[model samples]
Target: MTTYAIAHLHQTELCAEIVEYLEKIDGTLAPFGGRFIIHGGRVEQLEGKFRGNLIVIEFDDRERARTWYRSPAYQAILPLRTRHASGDVFFIDQVAQPHRATDILEGIRVPTAGVAP
Candidate 1:
């Protein structure tokens, strides 16, 4: 299954170290078949609080995602991110096919013959 690395970054210090980190991150991820799907684009918050940048990365599988994060190459540059920004990162497995609301609630015995509320 495909895996994803999602991050909600906050409070960036944007320095030379961060620049170095940015320059090297792609090289580090390439070995694990990791690539950025989203990196620093305009964000519109629909709910709750959001700050700083948002990043999403895709990998071949859960193990690949975990391996990339825990690899020595990434470890070497982790401090740059920690020093420059604070955020949350998570790995999630993708569902084979995303469900519609009714499809997701099928277990609840909601009739799918018509629109469900």
Candidate 2:
């Protein structure tokens, strides 16, 4: 399954630190099969409220996404981000295929045979 690193920054300060973070983040991702899908693009609020920038990175799986975030390479430069902005960071695994609401509901209707059925 694919995973995404979703970063929603609420406050940001443009400075040399951000510059360095941008410059080096790609290099850190290359080794872990991670790539930027969205990098500070213009965000249009359709329904609710949102602030600052949204960065989405795709990785091979949840483990790789976690590893990339915790790796020494990324950890070393994390302070730069923390120093400039603050927001939510998390990983979400993507569904392998599109499914209807009923299909998803059926998936949770019964427990597994061995576990709790």
Candidate 3:
């Protein structure tokens, strides 16, 4: 299954370190087949407030995504972005096709009758 590395970066500093990080990040991702699906483009907000930039990188699978994140190349430059930006970063697996909105309910362990959840 495809996996994504998503980040919501706020209060980013456009400094020399950040510029260097941007230049070198692609090289780190290439070996892992990771590519940017979204790179902080303009937003067309239709709901609640949003600020800062959103970045999404796609990987072939969860293993590849995890390996890339832990690889020395990515780890080397990790501090560059961390030092200049504040935000959230996480990995998420893509849902399978022919899916329903409630498919996630299957993973929930519903409380048994008369038992506390």
Most lDDT-accurate candidate:
3
**What clash pairs does model 1 have?**
none
For model 2, what is the alpha-carbon lDDT of residue 106? 60
lDDT, candidate 1, equals 0.90
Query: Clashes in model 2: which pairs?
Result: none
State every prediction's TM-score relative to the real structure: 0.82, 0.85, 0.89
TM-score leaderboard ranking: 3, 2, 1
lDDT string, candidate 3, 1-117, tens digits? 999999999779999999999999999999999999999999999999999999999999999999999999999999999999999999999999989998988979878999887
Off by over 4 Å in 1: 102-117
TM-score of 3: 0.89
| Alpha carbon lDDT of each predicted model | 0.90, 0.90, 0.96
lDDT of 3 at 70: 99
Model 3 CA deviation exceeding 4 Å by range: 107-117
> What value does the lDDT take at residue 106 in candidate 1?
53
Compared with the true structure, what per-residue lDDT tens digits does model 1 show for residues 12-104? Answer: 898999999999999999999999999989988899988889899999999999999999999999898888888888998877676565665
Per-residue lDDT of candidate 2, residues 1-83 (tens digit): 99999999999999999999989999999999999899888787899888888899999898999898999999999999899
Query: What's the candidate order when arranged by decreasing lDDT?
Result: 3, 2, 1
User: Considering every candidate listed, which one attains the maximal TM-score?
Assistant: 3
